[model samples]
Target: MNILLTGASGFVGRELVRELQQRADISLALALRSPGRSSGPTTFVVGELAVDTDWLAALARQQAVIHAAARAHIMKDEVADPLAEYRRVNVEGTLNLARQAAAAGVKRFIFISSIKVNGEATVNGKAFGADDKPAPEDAYGLSKLEAERGLIQLAAETGMEVVIIRPPLVYGPGVKGNFASMIKLVEKGLPLPLGAIHNQRSLVGIDNLVDLIICCIDHPAAANQVFLAGDGEDLSTTELLRGVGKAMGKPARLIPVPAGLLQLGATLLGKKAMAQRLLGSLQVDISKTCQLLDWKPPYTVEEGLRRCFGRSN
Candidate 1:
């Protein structure tokens, strides 16, 4: 099978490429902005991501496509209209690729979406399910939701299988942003106020996410399905930090602070949304993925952390 994978240089895409190379039956055609940067037994097509970008070279003779590239969510707005920028790449670019793939006779398209499509946080201990109506809370989430809808409609019209996988807080080696910041803080033994946060959150390991994407490539049951991917275990912010500490062979120093006070301080500092992510509950129920595909995460949170931090032999 020839698979066209976009975003070959991204955090997830790099790891996914390593995983894909292990499969002897699959050949890769990487879609990158700079084809000269990648040297492998894979085909590299140079194309920008936008409404008018060409995808014929990437889609030709490919059996499936794993669309992993997108405009990532930003914490601060430097752009005049962030939604339009997000729509330009995530929605319009995605649909353009999907339509071209369908025209090229690609059988399956795997969309890597985010849990934000189900909303930022869970309500009253209820986990977000695949069947839940989308309630995207931000520009990035809304764009992803729009892309999913377009892909499903395209699938219906063209007989191409579309598989949507929504993952929450993916972590692994080379992780950046908030997850990396937290790890750095934990390694430094800095005092954190999140010990008082009692909210639960679901996180997926990159290996597990890559595994699920491979499963969706050829599974008949994955056609036109929306699935949530996670480690099947949820943890509180305090527990997550402690786990990080353990993986780093360090002790966590946690200072008890009320979640309300934390939120108030974040609001004053213009970090209320970031505070909510740390203190809020965002659980995902991945039962449908398991029941339909007979799949389970191959790595636990601890093992994933150990491997990521180089604590495992």
Candidate 2:
């Protein structure tokens, strides 16, 4: 089937492109924001994401679209109005693309969303699920939630299929941001203060997320569905650090700092929210996704981490 994919150069997009390239049955039309060179069976279309960005040509004859491009979440945003900025690109741009794609008779639209839409963290033993009401705390999460609503509305009005996948902390080879920083600290054998953090968090590897995206592209049961994607296992902060350390051939070297003291230090340093991310639980339940498509994450947490760290176990 012929498909149109956006954000072909991003972390997840890069892996998706590599995986899609190996599939002889699929043809890809990559919509990029910059002037990118096209090659092989993939065609690159240069266009930015905005209300006025032209996507008619890209949508033409495409059976499905995997929309991955968006104004990504920033840990320390410098924008004056972050919500407005996110709305302009994520909500407005996404809806613009969907409206045009629907007009062009695109069969399905797959949206890559975040677990933040369900809230920043989970309490007690409860985990975020597909049926939970959205409670986006930050601008980026709010924008994605709005975009999901718009896509569902478009699907209802225009008869186009819409599939939403919310993944929690995707990590793998070439992963950046906090994950990469953690890997570096582990590689250097630096002492970390995460030993007391017993909070559980769910993380999906890039390979597993790509596999689910491929499934949603053509699965009949995926139409108009919201699914959570994970590695099928949750881990504590200490466990995650230890795994990373082991993968990098180093010691965990974690100091047993009290969680309350850590929180207070973060508050004094104006990084309280960031500390919560490291110390609090944010688990996602992928049972609905598995049961719907008869799917399971093909890689275990350890295997995925080993692959991500470029090590063999």
Candidate 3:
């Protein structure tokens, strides 16, 4: 199979490139945004992702496309028109590529979406399912939802198989942003006040997400289906901190603070959004993915944390 992967230098895309290269039956090509991003005969620089970006050379003889590029969600976006900016890259650029890929005879197009498309948080332990009605709250989530709708409609019209995978917080060795910040704080032995918070959140390891992407590449059951990706284990904030400490061989120093008081303080400090992420529940149901594809996450949350900290045990 000849596969073309976009966003080859990104966090998940880098891992995908490494895994795909190890497969003997796959010939991989990277559709990078600029030259010299990667050094290989198969690397094609297609410039910025937009409606008019040229992808003719990269799409030639490519059987499938794994598109992972987008203007990611920003917590404090300074742009005047954040929604328009997000749509420029996430919706318009994505649909443009899908239309061209369908015309180029690509059989399958796998899109990496986010769990935010379902909503910000699930209430009362009800996990977000794959078939739930979309309720995107932010500009980024709305853009992704638009892109998904366009892809599904294009698949119906063009006969190209489209698979959408929505993954929640992906954490691995090269993880950045909030996950990386948490690891750093834990490494420094800072006492955190999240011990009393019992919010359950779902997380997917990079390996697990990449495995699902590979499964969707050729699985007949995956055609035009939306799959939620996760590690199949949900963790509370306190449990997650302890798990990280255990993986790093350090005991977490946690102070048992009332969740209500914490939320009050966050609201006073104008950090309510950040507090919600730490004190709220956002879980995903991956049972459909397992039943349809007969796939289980190869790594458990504990094993994934161990790998993240470079521990073999």
Candidate 4:
């Protein structure tokens, strides 16, 4: 398979290349905003996703294109205006690229979307599925939802196949974002008050996410489908912290703080958003994906966590 992948240097994309390159039959061509790096079997192209002009030839030749580029969430920069920037790249940029891929007769266009599109806070014990209504809270998620809408509309008008995979929180080697921060906290022996928090959240390992993406690329039913994927197990903040502690060879010192008070303090300290993410539930149901594709995750949550734990501190 000749595949065009974006965000090659990003967390998921980097591991994705490593996993996909093992197959002698797969050829990878990476599209980046700047071609400043190279690794494994990937060849780079320097161009931003915001433009409608280039990448046509490359898109025409590749059998599949996995769109993984997007503006990620930031904690302190909540009030900042990133809509224009996100729309330029995540929305308009995605549509432009998809249109080119469709015109080029590409077999499939797989979009890596965030589970944030389904919700801002956790759905408690409830699991989010592919058919749930979109309720994007922040600008980043809203932009992603817009991009998803545009892709569906485009697919309807064209014969191109569209597959959307919404993952809760993906963590693994070279992982940044909240997962990395948690690892840092655990490594430093910080006193965490999450032991009392029993919220269930689902997360995807970089390897597991890549495996699902590969399945979607070749699965016939994945066409014009929206799937929510995870590690197939939901763990609470306390449980996750314990796992991280175990992986780091240290037990997490969880405090018995009230969830309400934690939320209050976070709000007072201008960290309400952060508190919600850590204390709330963000579970996803991968049953549809599993049943439809007849696929099983190659690694369990413990194995995935161990992979990141070994890489961190």
By lDDT, the best candidate is: 3
Candidate of highest TM-score: 3
Q: For model 3, how does the per-residue alpha-carbon lDDT over 1-313 read when each residue is reduced to its tens digit?
A: 9999998889999999999999999999999887875455399889999999988999999999999998998989999999999999999999999999999999999999999999999998999999999999999999999999999999999999999999999999989999999888888999999888888999999989999999999999999999999999999999999999999998788899999999999999999999988999999999999999999999999999998989997
TM-score of each: 0.97, 0.98, 0.99, 0.94
Model 4 segments more than 4 A misplaced: 38-44, 78-80, 311-313
Residue 269, candidate 2: C-alpha displacement in angstroms: 2.5
Between candidates 3 and 4, the one scoring higher on lDDT is: 3
Residue lDDT tens for model 1, 1-313 = 9999998788889998899988899998888877565467576665778888888877889999999999988888699999999999999999999999999999999999999999999868999999999999999999999999999999999999999999999999999989999989998888988788899999999989998999999988999999999999999999999999888889789998999999999999999788888998999999999999999999999999898888873
lDDT of 2 by residue, 1-313 (tens): 9999998889988888889988999988889787766565456565779998888778889999999999998988998999999999999999999999999999999999999899999999699999899999999999999999999999999999999999999999989999998888888878889887888999999999999999999999999999999999999999999988887778699999998899999999999788988888999999999999999999999999899878887
Spell out the clash pairs found in candidate 1.
none
Candidate 4 residue pairs in backbone clash:
122-281
- By summed lDDT, which 10 consecutive residues of candidate 3 come out lowest? 32-41
Order of candidates by TM-score, top first? 3, 2, 1, 4
Q: How do the residues 166-196 of candidate 4 rate in per-residue lDDT, one tens digit apiece?
A: 9888988778878888988988898988778
lDDT of each: 0.91, 0.91, 0.94, 0.84
Pitting candidate 1 against candidate 3, the one with the higher TM-score is 3
Candidate 2: minimum summed lDDT over ten consecutive residues — where? 37-46
